[model samples]
Target: MKPENAIEVRDLKKSFKVYFDKGNSLKEKAIHKKRNRYEIREVLKGISFEVKKGEAIGLIGHNGCGKSTTLKLLTKIIYPDSGSIDMCGRVSSLIELGAGFHPDMSGRENIYTNAAIFGLSKKEIDERLDDIIRFSELEEYIDNPVRTYSSGMYMRLAFSVAINVNAEILLIDEILAVGDVNFQEKCFDKLKDIKRAGTTIVIVSHSLDQVERICDRSYWIDEGEIRAEGDPISVHEAYLTAMNQSMQERLEKEDAEVMEQHKKLGQARLMPVFCSDIAERKGTFDVEFSDIKALNSIGEKKRTFHSGEAVRLRFAYKNPNHVPQANIKFSLYRDDGILVYENNYEFATGKVLDLKDEGEVNVEFPTFGYAKGTYLLNAVMYPPGGGEVFDEINNVFKITVFSEERAMGVYLLENHWEEA
Candidate 1:
């Protein structure tokens, strides 16, 4: 029987000694390691929580905000500086999936090693081997060394191994975020099955939608403290608001002129986050609400499309500078580093925003045309002089395209398939 609380943590804290002399050569650190002075970073402060048996929980916060530390501490990868964790059952952690597998080993052999580390018998693994390979969707590559496998493969096999092990507790940190859309969907279905089997799940993710969708509860961590803990929707909302505030703070400190130029751009108002690309593309929908915020609206902009249908992408960003003749450029790439498409605003717009005197411009692109694959958007600010990029967001937006009826390929030709 599962314990009442699958995992219980109290007064948890984890700290690391971060060295500041970034210029110091490796030799210096090796020589003075014992006496080296370092800055103390309290990644996780004193925190406490309990996950009832079969409860699905999420941890969200800014990067380096101690969410990873908490997950690591619970999995015993790194012991807490001070606190206690009471785990009632076996844990299958995908913290840094395949953390200690030998690259020279074939996928089959690595599965044995990974399963053994989780305390599974070789016989147990053998019985589950076919299922593991099938779940991983790498049947043909099972005999190949993991060294030859792509990063995506590593994530697939790692996740497959973790999920297959029949553990009572599962710690997942954006694990499904790695694979392709098809693989991700398969993994999600597996996760739902796991949940149905009553496995306690704890997830750490940058994706608010996933948290809200799968997690029953959520936590927002800030500077090693539990800032909020409650229902997924409420907690995620708090995290989003906190993130936007931090981004604003970072921009304020990055440059003085940035703030001044932002003030000079038309009427100064925060950009309302736009989620509906289809609706926004027609230029007929404002999709605006006084309560809709940039961080909160991020999930809406990313629409999950069926395989054969067209996708409308909407991007809303504040221009920190009031430079005229600035055009937007977008680049689309598959997760495998393949450049699918690229286009520039200079050719699309042919002119500047007349409201350049204003502090901000919220532009929408109804970019439609693509095949079944996940594509990311790379945006850049183009100035007329072309001296340097006034602003740029590298792969800021991502969308996964999948249609059940569409065949897998780079482009969908407007022609019927014919047999030779």
Candidate 2:
């Protein structure tokens, strides 16, 4: 029988002392007379949450964000520095799949060994051994040494043994990502069955889609703290928004630093120019695209084009000083930010041009090999090595392409199909 509250964690805090070794041998250590220094790395800060019987919870975050550490703490693999964890009923953990199995032992022997570690008696193991091996689909290789098993095979056997354990609380740490798609679906179906049978589960995974599908709720952990706790989909959305914002800020800062270095080198002047057209302008101080216009096949200033039509992209630049070594990189992106193609002017031609005043640059795409959809054009100016970008206009222009044939994806590959 499952308890009402399967697990309750209160102000959980854990840290480890990371060591820096000076010498490996005792003689060397004595000669150096230096002690190894250590730094305290806090893996889990004060965090609190609860899991009810039959509830499936998810822990999501970037790598080293304490998701795995929390699972380890729950399994008592490591003791917490402070705080309390109230766990009820028998617990079985698959922290690292096949972690405790003997490499030289046969898969059948390893199953008995692992199950015994999970608190199964010899008679209990005997009763479930056939079912476990059948579930893993490894009956032929059950007597083979585990060292010869492939990763997917190992995972199948490990998960099979784990699910067979009579555990009220299951701790899974991204083990489901292993194996083929068919086996993955089988694992999901099995999980659903177990969940319906009142088995509590805690899964730590990077796959937000799987998390949202399997977990009743999710907690986004960041910097060893609970950033958000709510519905799985909403929590994942919040996490993604925060991650994108942080990435954008870091990129902007890097761009600013690059421009500042260029200013110090006397390459260009730093001036924050204001854009008169808010809808089409995007850039920093070093360079700016004041006006951009797209021309169709008939030389008309339009933002839409037909398949295989000639499209010309024209843009005028504004700069404070001469950039003799600068080049322009033009790229096409889908509405969802997938880059389709990119081309550079000076880099392709092996020529450098000076831009001291308002200059015009244009590029023509003779064959617009894209399916019917809306797209964005991104223009960026950079130096020879592209170590730093002078200025970039993301989504400089939004254009739509028309096609007669309904394609599945964005690209249009030239292919002729005939049935044999």
Candidate 3:
């Protein structure tokens, strides 16, 4: 059988040459050649992978681990030191906040410029302009320079133009992290529609649930290499297990070192007492455990949910400092890190959370709007009168979406359908 692929890569390598001074002349170039050589920042490390047509794949790894570097090479934003990105069909990328736009231009003008760069004709941009503006929900601000727009607004317009390009293959990074709830939902619905049109997608996200939900498969990258690929669940599980193990190992080593230092110094850094217990979803089950580390709580909470079910989460914890009026938020992701839902509990309007008490606060949201498959839930706690977020909870839970007997519309509709 011939090698199967939609995107082909072999022995990919990329490096950046760091120049200390920009004004160096030819004489300096010669002198540097004879004396000090330019420093190299090796980004991609001889990695390789292939993506089949109509397949959705997720890429995940630590920060600065060449995930974005590979995307840049694929999109031709930067040339690789070695290797090739062999792609067939019309391709488009929503990499790095979705679009390249000038801040001084109006939304309309920037859309025109960006669309043309994506290989669309002026007439094509004109045809899509209305659709773009409507989707971005920036009709009033369309005439304003993008420099005046908020980060969320800027991202909205950029994404609006990106999805309308009608490319055969689309590349997306983590742009959904900034938009509000309503806009994010709209964009996600559009993504589902785009996938149905047979456009291949490659998403690089920290949202494991989004990857597991939409991706036909996934690619796990580690240390600039493809560590795992195939089914999203299997690959995701493997990665999580590995990460947990690594965290455990590090904690153990640190504990031993700290104890040894304390013996010699008479007293050492005071290790914070851990609540220790945490909730985590193991494949399909919800897990709770305590006292594994004796110090800081060392695990995450995870669960799976189906559609139309009452999605309820109770957060329980202990913090010494009293939080007077904190801005607490919950974020949902369809794994691979595409942010699905996010909201903060500010003491504004009708928001209230008595985190000072020992009782758990149960957060309930109807889940009928979500499609079938597993989803991830993230919870964040901020101190009262927040200047900076002190702590974070990562991938706390997983929720599954069901749509068999429960199926009605694309997602479960809250309204009752009466026969006409």
Indicate which candidate wins on TM-score.
Answer: 2
List where candidate 1 sits over 4 angstroms from the true fold: 1-3, 21-35, 255-420
Q: Each model's TM-score, in the order given?
A: 0.60, 0.65, 0.59
Better of 1 and 3 by TM-score: 1
The per-prediction CA RMSD against the true structure, in angstroms, equals 13.1, 11.5, 13.6
Q: Tell how far residue 178 is off in model 3, in angstroms.
A: 3.8
lDDT of 3 by residue, 1-420 (tens): 124567888889988876556436887677666444557888788888888877778888767878887887888888888887788889888875535689898888999988887889999888888999999999999999999999899888888899899888899887656589888888888888888887888888887877777788888888788888889888887886676556546655664564466556543322212221223322110111111121111223223333555555555545444444444566777755667667676633366555452334445564435765545555556654555554455555445444433243335556688999
Predicted candidate 1 versus true structure: per-residue lDDT over 112-218, tens digit per residue: 99988888998999988989999998999999999999999988998888889988999988776858999888888888888889999999998878887788999
Q: Write the per-residue lDDT of candidate 2 for residues 185-222, one digit (tens) a residue.
A: 99899988888999999999988878877899999999
- lDDT for model 3: 0.68
**C-alpha lDDT values of all predictions:** 0.70, 0.80, 0.68
Model 1 local distance difference test score:
0.70
Q: What lDDT is reached at residue 338 by model 1?
A: 94
Residue 197 miss distance in model 2 (angstroms): 0.9
**True lDDT of residue 420, candidate 1:** 100
